[model samples]
Target: MSHRPKTAALIAYAEALLSPEGQRRVEAHLAGCEACRAELAAIEAYDALVEDVRSVEIPTIDFASMELPLAREAEAVSRQMIAQRQRRSARPWIAAGLVAAAAAAALWWSTRETEPQAPPRAEAPVEREAPAPVIAPEPARLTPVVTLAAGEVRRETADGEIPLELGAVLDEGARVGTGAASELHVRLADGTGFRLAASSALALARAREDEIRLELAQGSVGHAVAPLSNGAAFVVLAAGYSVEVTGTRFVVSALDGTVGVDLSEGAVRIRPPRGEPIELEAPARWRSSGGAEGGAPRPVSVRGLEAPRVAPTPVRLADARMIRWSVDGIEIETSGDVQLGLAPGEHPVRAWDARGRLHTALLPVGGAPVELSAGALQADAPRVRAGHLDEADLRPVLSRGMRQVQRCYELALRQGTGAVTGRARLRIEIGLTGGVQRAQVLGIPESSLTECITSYASRWTFPPPGGPLTVEQPLTLAPTQ
Candidate 1:
């Protein structure tokens, strides 16, 4: 206690690998020691550098082309020696005397090889054309431009680090990093682009025509890749694995020794360093347990609602511990304030408090931006102005009805649309004494699933609201993982 913590202990503490008691001890010391805290920061920085080095792309080499010029030079020298031998062979006696003299000359030359020799006489030197210069293959036409830079984003180049601005073209090997709460978006000349999340580091490792590789050392990225030409590939290297895709919309993350991939559309092949490659299709999720070979992807039961094809309205929300919203049945989750694209309708909004309790609100989206406050959601209050249902009372009732929701989705999946996956919104009106007053389905196309859900929901009961209370519920349908 009187001395300082060792380097190994500090490392374990930084990685959160120490026991709870050890963590408490280290933290207590850190609270009083600035030098130890600085050491811990340096340790984390070095670890990040090592992760970046691991994601570097190894360039391919063509050995045949490199050796061609040397091979030709050796061949030319051999031909010149043959011609000299032929000239000497025409005079046999002279050639025999010269060969005997050459032996003694060779013996003398061996002993003097280490000594500095005099320059060749002007006429004694043989002239030869310099070997043709080796021409390198042309580099790929990869031009990436910064499309968006939000908050504190910087790019590292040979000329040193610079603040990344809109329209700046990124050079290959350049690394981009985002500070906390910052994000960055970059688009390639080929219509491929990616959005980097906060507190992330990514390197544009390679940009050859045959292959384009992005190295992700930390955080997450959402990518939209255009279809590549024949024999071309797009790859994302993260942690110890690589994701290769021709064209796709997906999300990849390399954070805290964990790597994950969520494929919304298109197909991809993931390769681990020591295992066989994994193939993934659309609407699937893959995660690894701190190693490329540790885990596999599974199909997700839920997916976010797709933004409307046409111009959709944007809804903004206030900061919260966690905010979840659903429009037309698709739900999305994020922390802090964010803008969401929603179709013209009334969407359900949910936010969590510090103690993890849910608060609910109804946000109407039309044209102008609508601002929602998590602290203002009153739908969950136990006695809300004498007409509302409290979140504490609503959550348990919905939880008990999840079986009906699953049943409806499973029945619909069996009805020849097995591959179909989407979200559906259900609207229910509860009357006094917890009676179901009305039930309706919104957002999803009308089908047997909708009919089944509506029929089951109308008969459900909940704790009594003083008066009429209407709420929207979200349901997601997908194949079993």
Candidate 2:
């Protein structure tokens, strides 16, 4: 057999083994391996030799076309045939082509198969569902043990101390910002129980019975009975008032040298100076010229004690001998001495306890007293048109000789995190030495900076030299994103 290559090499070129005319060339080669590939390089060499031979005073001519002698032409034809036969053999290129074709097919098929799936294993994480919603616990339903904090005092439920630093616990969720207040309700290791709400100023007196008793030394405090008992009693010692609590939750606020008690649902009795008693049923209030006999309100703690009962039907503020008691609801009139009436329930009474003063105490029957008193007569300052005021209306820093007077420019506002919207323009008059200092926004939600400014040129009185004038702009804040 002839040393012939297989058609796969042609197919490899036809597919790998082929070109545009590669199939025809391959078929022809298959038909006759004798016509395998002819080498043009040797033919060109023969043409150059013919040129050299004829260049001697003559032009070149095709030696193959010339009618040369028969023996010489035959010899040349045989030699050309031999050279063509030699070129037909592909001893070198056939082996290399087979190896290259095999490698190319293997590589193309291997890479495209399954490699794409591997990289996708590192895809982004899928979102997970959020946990279930947590219900805000109901105050009335918590287990008695869980109702109070391990060490929460004064208020209802206290977890780790409240975010608030100093606060007076009025009722369950109700409280006031006493100048300062601290509360604790810690469970004892032995299962014994203790609770405390230190007033801005505190006083502790001996107690009796299952009741919690505290003497209002010179301040006021709120207390809850031990172990979630209903009949918890506390004492409030304020400037000119004293109170004895029975079974209930109440808060006593001592401010400006006075004590005011507000009962949420429990009963407390107002004990005026000299051990006089004025009973306050739930929601009743009782206030006096002072929380304690001779001092400002102070916190009093009386645990495990009975509420001190007045032997006789105690004399109340209605029976204030030195300070007569006469009232038309909140507005009370006193001539020579101060008049006080301890209403039935909680009340925030405002009293004008000046030598010749009248106080308006809006007593909430059994609540705390809201007192409103007039300072020494203040002549009314002139008022200006609201549109005529501007930032210059702010009081000028006083100058004494070469010295400059300075005061803290406080931007007073309601400290809260909730948002509130405004629907109307609100106007407020800030009180000053003479009269209205600045007219500003009240109860209208706006920019805090805008409230600090005046609509026109205004004059204000900053007392002494370093004190600030209060801006009576009411604001509201709400909770949102």
Candidate 3:
């Protein structure tokens, strides 16, 4: 009927072998139960005593003292047995033998110790150091922003080249390229605008808070830089030259191992591969040929010529020979001479002589009448057709023709006495056989370059088209710098 814990419960509590709930219950009971507490204390003392006994060495027994009692008892038992045997029969002898045996067993039981043995000590748990904490490296940070893209443009990234949409974001170190007859317009986060012409390749070298650097591998680019904070640097690397500008509008062209820069507004500093830095202002141009040797900037004279009073005035050739004239890129029919009006900008006027030789002249019209000679025309220039001709359809042919003409032009520019500057327009007529049937050049003078370009165009073959095609294209040579 007692509510106190049993001896087994006390042992369980001492060894911490009870469940959490049972231990809590036993602890609560012990707090108000004095009897259980005393019992637990006695059990703990007994455990301590057992441990002490096991730790101490056993002493040698006093064999003489132990043997004397057993000897006296054995002598008494013998004397009684002899006395009984003399007085009674053999049954009395048997009873005395049993008595002596009982006495010996009692003596042995009284000599032994009454304490319980201690349990074996458990082996200490093997200690193992916890594995070192795993530390992970921090990830790299990247800043990317969306920019404008147009016309067969693609960006080269870590995953390979991806076609760019109108507002695709580009990260630092992204390389952008454009196909033939294609162009790209992009604006940076800093409001700087970049216009890349066809067949161009550019790499965004760095885009950071303090600077934005670009590398121009080939072709041309126009930069319209916005105002910048002090110490902000905008640099462009092209061929063997480097262009550094704070805030300006300029054009950088890297072609045929030469780098040319034309400043339209503000000023820029050009650093050649091996020469002193050359500073240029608006309306000035400079070029270098992949070396440290720097060249002087040349002034581009913009004469404000007047527009003609009459619209579509008579264009009379001094020889009065039958010829064809084109305003802009459109061919015009004429019996002996052609009558055309001049516009307020540079107009590419082309003429075809009787022998089908092409001549071109770029007429800068301000507000007056302008005249051009037949020899000032260039023939067989590449042109972009109107309508929805797929760039894929036109690129291969146009690219090939332009490349041929460009080589000839570069050669002539290097060797010819006169400066080969200004824009030239070429009107090409592809025949049914994919050969150039008739080619005319506009806005450039008749020279070895023109003749060479025409001869090359005449022999050039294009992929067969759905029909005969007419293409008029304008080519601009970098001005002397």
Cα lDDT listed for each candidate: 0.68, 0.36, 0.62
Candidate 1 vs candidate 3, lDDT winner: 1
What is residue 425's positional error in candidate 1, in angstroms? 25
Stretches of candidate 3 off by over 4 Å are: 1-147, 290-481
TM-score quality measure for candidate 1: 0.39
State in Å the error of residue 393, model 3. Answer: 42
Candidate 3 CA-lDDT value: 0.62
List candidate 2 stretches off by more than 4 Å: 1-182, 186-199, 207-211, 226-236, 274-276, 289-481
lDDT of 1: 0.68
Best-fitting candidate, scored by lDDT:
1
State the lDDT of candidate 2 residue by residue for 1-481, as single tens digits: 7564553454354344466587666666656564233322234455688788888675577653443365356646644543332221112222234345655345334433333212212221110121223333221211011111111123213452332211121221222211222333222111222233433433333222233334444344555433334543445556556666544556676656556776655566776666657787765554555333333322323221221121111112321211222233323222222222232444443333334343334434422332323332222233332232233453342222002100111222234322344332324343424244555544444454334333321343433312223433233332223
Worst 10-residue lDDT window, candidate 3: 119-128
lDDT of 2 at 72: 56
